[model samples]
Target: MDGFDRFRAPPPDMLVMRPLDSMVAIFHRPSGRTHVVASPVPEILESLGPDPTDVATLLARLSERFDLAAGDREALLARLGELEAAGLVERL
Candidate 1:
């Protein structure tokens, strides 16, 4: 949780993502694994531009782009945890 501002998407060269309707199929070149992720995941990755971003900044950006509810922090954080666990994102 420390250094949250250092959170960033995985290295671009290590991922190959493709949209599949409402879902996304991400192929991790490093792990040689494929993941079928839903909304928020794809959206989150897209929102994470080319730089590291903190939760607050990311939340604000996501809110502007998506129709997020009044309180979606927990949900987004939870999804971020999952993505980190899956090695799609990292905290520096």
Candidate 2:
């Protein structure tokens, strides 16, 4: 997979998310940890069972939900990359 693939929605068993204040907190239950995350661009939290969604799908959803501009999309993806690398999230 390429770098973009890492932005996927993550596997069901490996993740959980809840809305908190204006932010969303994603949890990696297998590791008993969580991270508070937010994006100016909107997205729906989806559960994909053992499998995870692809990054393109996620970007599409976010773009649709928030009508994000190219710059916003890039920024949001960048922040998500940081979260993923921190083990606060995983790509399936």
- Name the candidate that leads on lDDT: 1
TM-score of each: 0.83, 0.58
CA-lDDT, candidates in order: 0.80, 0.57
Ten contiguous residues with the weakest lDDT in model 1: 1-10
Residue pairs that clash (backbone atoms under 3 angstroms), model 1: none
| Number of backbone collisions per candidate | 0, 0
Candidate 1 residue-wise lDDT at 47: 84
Clashing pairs for predicted structure model 2, backbone only = none
